[model samples]
Target: MATVEQNVSEFRGIIFLVRILFHADIYREALLSRLIILTLFSYFFQNDWSQAVTKFYRTPLLYERSYLNFLYLQNKFSSTKKYKKVTHCLFDLDGTILDSEIIYHKAIQKICERYGKTYTKKLQNQLYGVTDRQLSIGVVSALKLPISVDDFEKQMTELVQKNLTDSPFKEGAERLLWHLSTSKIPIALVTNSTDQAVQMHAKARPKLFSLFHHKVCITDPEVKRGKPEPDMYLLGAARFTPKANPTQCLVFEDSVVGVEAAVRAKMQVVMVPDYRIDKELTLKATIVLKSLLDLDPTLFGIPAFKDGVKRGS
Candidate 1:
């Protein structure tokens, strides 16, 4: 006869084998049942089986307790659609919705030459989306220019006017603006450009400017700070709601500082970055687009742009 240890070892091995066989049978039966159900459904419903099954199994009793999760989610999300929360569209000037980057590049180059300094793309990026005084001081510091800040500002202001124009619109930018205006979504223009430059650009591209319910520029005496400081973005929000909860608006920008400022203001931002703004910096933005033209009504949670549009005269 086998010893106690030997018998126990044999018994354990047999039990393990039996357990494995039982599991194998259960799995095989489950698979077979699933296949049979699928075959029957397919034979009757053809391509529509999935939809039919989904509709049929929508009841809680047909599924596990966890299946009710989506129902709760649906209810949770449905309430948001009931009330149309005022959505404001905040636009950045310069390289964003406008093709003002090239003009600014030339303007900065002229300022650098006047001050006996060289302007690099990196330096321009650092200064981009900043106000005239702020840009002058920042550029002078970054380039180690010998010129006084006052002189630098004067030269840049002159050069910017000479070089800048509203010639070509960013792809879909005009269309998106039109859609937003028609949808009755209040829009506001926010930029670090001086009041003069902002006005000129707006005059040239009235389609975009006209869409905005309010326009906030760095030139405004009340606006003491610029991008990366959150002042301009906050000012833009005030245009729509004085107590503008940044959470209610969507900001569109093309620079790192712009996105940072929008984030600081607690607003949703979409970045359409240029060569100067890095992808990493734009990560703070809610959405990053190749261009403003890429925006659609669905982005604002609307079913369609045409559906919501209230034509403006």
Candidate 2:
């Protein structure tokens, strides 16, 4: 008896002769005939029937392994359109969650006034969502203030702390935070703000800020660079309990620099920018919303609200 293996191997050798049947119909019919013949052979083999069927199914169609790999590569190349799927969310603090841009501007302007200098809008926009060192150094250098970087940092911190302790939340900010929290989605605060700044800002709404799985402050010792550099966002994404990759995270921001950081980190970002921010800068984000209210969670593969953005307070 030519064993079942020998019989199947012989069939495969015979099929290989017509390997040039690249046309779909020809290949399908060829495979169909092989399967039908195998079915009939199974009746006689009995014990070896399972073995014969297994080998036949496993080897045909360019061989199973090659067939599966082809399908996978085809799906990926079938469409150039990008799709976003996120399990973790990273959010920028200041302007994204809290209406602290004006507070920052006021603080810097106060310092400028004391030094007989002006805090221009151009400089204010540049300094937004940047590290304390970057902000202090840039401001002191730009305004030609006599204060040292350390002195500027100290003054700016004090003013921000005093005014920002009661800083209000931006439109739809609390609602979105609460929604994501209740959905059991992991969220992190990724910001250029210092630890002290975060503490001061969280005073009024500690519980809301507490909802964050972790906070990534650029001032943290591990962070070598700030926003527009991707270090902080990458660090934030890595802090998840089951650490997440950049592609698995979606960032929310209100600053152009923040958007650039998320994009560089290989993550998708939603920009809820200040009206004063230039439109061109907002375009860099994956999507731009007039306010967080306009966000559609499903677009980013997040669960949609049960009651549609939740009403009240």
Candidate 3:
């Protein structure tokens, strides 16, 4: 009969062999390791050590599989931690929340046609994130149109107001806004658009627009500068009832200039740029999502969607 010490030594040997098998990076890396495992298995079975033999057969395989699964879960968790929670939400209007960029594009194209200048996609992209004044200045300068900036802006404004009657919400925009409102998240609209223009655009969905706790427009006296400058976002946050720390606020933008403005305001920004925009321009944002559809609110510590609440619906 084996002494108690001998039995303990045998159990320790089995544990050591199991550890090696479980941790092996490559099972074929060494012939000796494989030979040792096989030898131990044979010895345990020959001794009729039922428990030891069963453990030797199952423990290493189970442990190795579980360890690999653990590594996968660890990687997944680390990826999701990239986004942080925010208390207040600010949104850019034209290309971000409302599909009103097309209205702007058509209006600009009409003006370009009058000047015998083509409104190229390049020009459209370059002027995408600027305020009405900036866009007017850019258009006049780029095309050398024989018109005053104020006059050009007036023409574009008229065209936009006429065409803005039924502008649809951008994909995932309505759902996200609804979710935020339902959850009682403080939200605001910070846009380069004029207050009048914003109202015109909202005509189709006044209830949704009404959900915003505040609307800070470029035309507001408090916003001295438009995007690519932080005035608009800073004012938006300040207007919140209790006010929000810039660092605790989150901004969603669809243009490079808007992202820069949010960053300058010292807020985290999620950029959902037009597909045609250059990817390099979006790199400065805290996160770049294809659309709000890709946003996992839970990543920002907000409640995630429940079952049956489809995104972009």
Candidate No. with top lDDT: 3
Error of 1 at 127 (Å): 2.7
Query: Model 2: residues >4 Å from true position, as ranges?
Result: 1-82, 309-313
Worst 10 residues of 3 by lDDT: 67-76
Alpha-carbon lDDT of model 2: 0.75
lDDT for each residue of candidate 1 in 1-313, tens digit (9 for 90 to 100): 5578755654553353333334333443343234335534553554443353445444445433212222222223333543223377788877777787777677888778876778886687676666678778998888888878898888877877875773467766777777777777778889887788877877776666877788888778878877888888888887675446677778888888888998899887777776334323554666565656444446456446553433310
Every model: Cα RMSD to truth: 18.7, 20.8, 18.7
Expressed as tens digits, the lDDT of each residue in 1-313 for candidate 3 is 9889768866865665565556544543244355446657677668644344344435555434433332333233346546778888999988889888888888999998998998898888888888888899999999999999999999998898887866778888988999988877899999988899887766777798899999999888877778889888999999999989888898999999999999999998988777656543665787776668767787777788664554320
Give per-residue lDDT, candidate 1, residue 251: 85
Query: Where does model 3 exceed 4 Å of error?
Result: 1-81, 307-313
RMSD to native, candidate 2:
20.8
Error of 2 at 71 (Å): 38
- Compared with the true structure, what per-residue lDDT tens digits does model 2 show for residues 1-313? 7888767855654353233233224443455445536644663566454465555555545344333332223222323536588899999988888888788788888999998999997787776667778889999998889989999989988888777876788888888899899988899999888887887766677799899999989779999988889899999988999899899898999888899999999998888766555443565677666678767788778888776553210
lDDT of 2 at 305: 71
TM-scores of all candidate predictions against the true structure:
0.65, 0.70, 0.72
